[model samples]
Structure formats: C-alpha cells, structure tokens
Target: MATYLITGATGGIGEAICRRLAPLHSLILVARDQAKLDALALTLGGSHHAWATDMGQDGAIDAFTARMESEQVTLDGVVLMPPQPHADDNPMPTPDVWRHLFQVSFIGPLALLKGAVARMNPDPAEGRRAKIVIISGISSAQVLSHYATANVIRTAWVGEAKTLAFALGSRGIHVNTLSLGGTLSPWYRDKLEERAQKNGISFQAQLTIETDNVPLRKYGEPAEVAIVVEGLLSQFSDHMTGLNILHDGGFTRAY
Candidate 1:
C-alpha cells in the first residue's frame, strides 16, 4: 500500500480523509497534538504512524523533515489541510492577524509540501507518480461576507499550487487544490448556530439561508470530501494537474 501524509489530522475533514484512506493505504497523521494524533492512529486500526508538529511556527517543516529522514520514510502523496483562519481575521485585519495567517496557512504548509516532494519523485523505487492535494475554501475564488484572511491566503495557495504543478509535471508529480464550499463540520455548525441566534431563526432556517445560493442547496459532508481526495490522489492524476477543482456543490458562481 502507498504511504500518504495527511496534515491537520485531527480536524473534521482531516479525520474523515484518514478513515477513508486507511482501508487502502498506510498513513502519516500530522497535527500539533501528539496525544490526539496517537488516538486517531489507533482508531484507524492499521500500521499508521503519527507525527505531531505545529505547522504554523518557524522551522516546523524543517524539523518534520529531520524526523522523517531519521526514520527513512518516503511519501507517495500528501493531503494538505491547513488550519482555517480564526475569528480575529477580519476585513481590516491587524498586522498580527496577517502574520499568523501567512505563517500558518501559506508558508508553513507549502514548505512541508516542498520537503515531502523532495523525498518523493525522481526515484524509481517510489513507484507511481506522486500526488499533492491542497484543501482550501471557495472563499479564495469567490467573495464571501467575511473571511478576509482566508480569501487572501488561500488564493495565494491556489496560485502557488498551479506554479508548483508546472515545475513538477515533468518529474511525475501532480499538484492541485480542492476548493471547498460549506461543509457540515463542527466549525460551520457553530457559525450557523451563531447566525441563527442573532437573526432569531432556527438552525435549519439558518442553514437553508446559508446554502440558498448553492445550486445543490446543500452543504458537503466530510466523508464526501474524503472521496474526492481519494480520486485526485489516484485516477484523476493520470492527465490532470495544476487545476483547482471545486467541491462546493455548485456554490461558486464565478468562472
């Protein structure tokens, strides 16, 4: 089985991806909480390994590579699910907000991708061409009411992925971004509930209003996200590269 590294392992979408991939492949679960990563590794019931490191801080990617080198582990693919912006990441963002967002969302994650791919491709022993799937939000491609930090940082990642795809295509590496819309994760649920309270409406009403613009009129589930990740890392890579595939249930209106 191929070994894939999944960053942000304990988050809603990350955990779902792990569960979906575990049956067919080995995993390297990455997150800041060693304890949580260990617990998740156990639940998946496999020969999975866990690596805990804060991808937001400086030198974090270097340290992760050091550990991987010591273990002589090479990756066949990656599923990068960087942290979403916090509540303070508003439109007129502060300096601190921008710094934190850039460090965690953009620099750190892309650094890890570079490091991981360095150990992959150009080696015949590594087998199939490597795949890199970056998980992001539709806000980067389309305007949202808020999410200023997400808009800027995720858009940068989209561009970076395309650039990387161009540089790595000849090396048998595929780089792409999965732009997501609303999903029924805990975080989104809380946001919907909060909006519902402010508008004096039921949670269902809030959810419907939120998804009204989506052609499917629905929010995606974490499991569905996992399925898409699996495809991109497998069949879809044969001829596709550098594309930011949208998983928004028709929520995006822009071209």
Candidate 2:
C-alpha cells in the first residue's frame, strides 16, 4: 500500500481528508498536538499513524524526513494542510510574522513536497503515480484585508506549485493546490462566532449575511472539501497539474 503524508492533520479540513483517505491508504498524520494526533489515529483505524511535529518550526522538515527514513517509509503522495487563520488581538503582520506565514504556507509545503517527490518510486511495478496536494485559502484571489498575510503567502504557494508541476511532470508527479472558500468546519464556526461577537451581531445573523454574499447561498461542508482533495489525488486528475481548483461556491468574481 502507498503511504500518504498529511500535515496539519488535526485541523478541520485536514482531519476530513485523513478520514476520507485513511481507509484506502496508509496515512502519516503530522501535527503539533500529540494527544490530538493519537486520538485521531485511534479513531481513524490502526492503519493510520501519527507524527508530532511543529510544521512552523525551523528544521522541522529535515527532522521529519529523518524520522521517515529511519522508519523505512517511502511516501507515494503528500497533502499540505497547514493552518493560516488568525483571531482577533493576535500580533500584527510584522516582518517576523510575515516570514513565519510565508514559511508555513510556502516554504514548508515546498520542503515536504521536495522530500516526498524525492522518495517516490513510481515504477510500473508500483502501479501508481506520485501526487502532491496543497490546501490553501480563497484569500489568494479575494484580498481579504484581515488576512493579508494569507493572501500574500498563499499566492506565493500557488505560484511555486505551478513551477514545481512543470518541473516534475516528466517524472509523473502531479502538483496542484485547492483554494478553499468558506467551509463550515469547527474552526470556521469558532472564527465566525468570534467575529460575530466582536461585531456585536448574533451568530445566525452573521451566517445569514455571509451566505447572502455567496452565490451558492451556503457554506461548504468539510466533506465537500474532502471530495475535492480526493479528486486531486486520484488517477483521474493525473493529467491536471499546476492548477488551482477553487472550491468557493462561485463566490469569487475574478475570471
């Protein structure tokens, strides 16, 4: 069985992807929270394993690579799912914060993909191609002022994925990013509640206003996002590389 490496596997979308993929493939779940990872591993079945690592920390990629090597793990695919949202009263976008966001959104994914792509052995005997899937935000296009750092960093990640797709296509490695819109996950619900409280509006009122803005008139479910991720990782999407698949329910106006 092919092994898939997933970062930020404790978060909403990430956890959804893990649950969706774990039954079919062996999963290596990476996150900072060991307890959460362990719990998720047990719930997802015994085929899933957890690796505790802070993806935001320096040298983390190298350390993770070493661990995988020691365990004789060769990854056939990777899912990059690092978190990027900031609640109220967090630090502003200073140079240090920008650097950290860029590293998490851009640098870290690149490093993980580099390692996974290097280790992938897509022989005819293996019967599968290697893939790299990144979970980014719609802010790459929508210039949300509150998420300026995410806008800048996710754009960079998209650009980098394009280049890597071209560079690795000849080796049968696919690279693509999924730009997500509003998904009704626990983290998003918490964020909405927090924003509503700050704005002096009821949570239902806030949802009503936001849904009115969406062309689909609803927030996407975590399973919807998971379906998109699965499609990107599937053989049917092998011909597609370096593309950004937007899952925003037609909320973005830009062509």
Candidate closest to the true structure, highest lDDT:
1
What is candidate 1's lDDT per residue for 1-255, written digit by digit as tens? 888999988988999999999998999999999999999999999899998988887677799988888888878899998787644446887798778788888888878877788777444245468899999898769767667768888889899999999999888888889999888877878888999999999999988898888899899999999999999999566689999999999978777
TM-score of each: 0.93, 0.90
Clashes in each model (backbone N, CA, C under 3 Å)? 0, 0
Task: Report the CA-based lDDT of candidate 1 relative to the real structure.
Answer: 0.86
Q: Which residue ranges in model 1 land beyond 4 Å of their true spot? A: 87-89, 122-127, 197-200
Root-mean-square deviation of each candidate, in angstroms? 2.0, 2.6
Poorly placed runs, candidate 2 (over 4 Å): 87-92, 124-127, 195-202
Please write out the lDDT profile of model 2 over residues 35-100, one tens digit for every residue: 999999999995887988776665887888777878888788888875675532243657787677
Give RMSD (Å) of candidate 2 vs. truth. Answer: 2.6
Instruction: Flag clash pairs in model 2.
Output: none
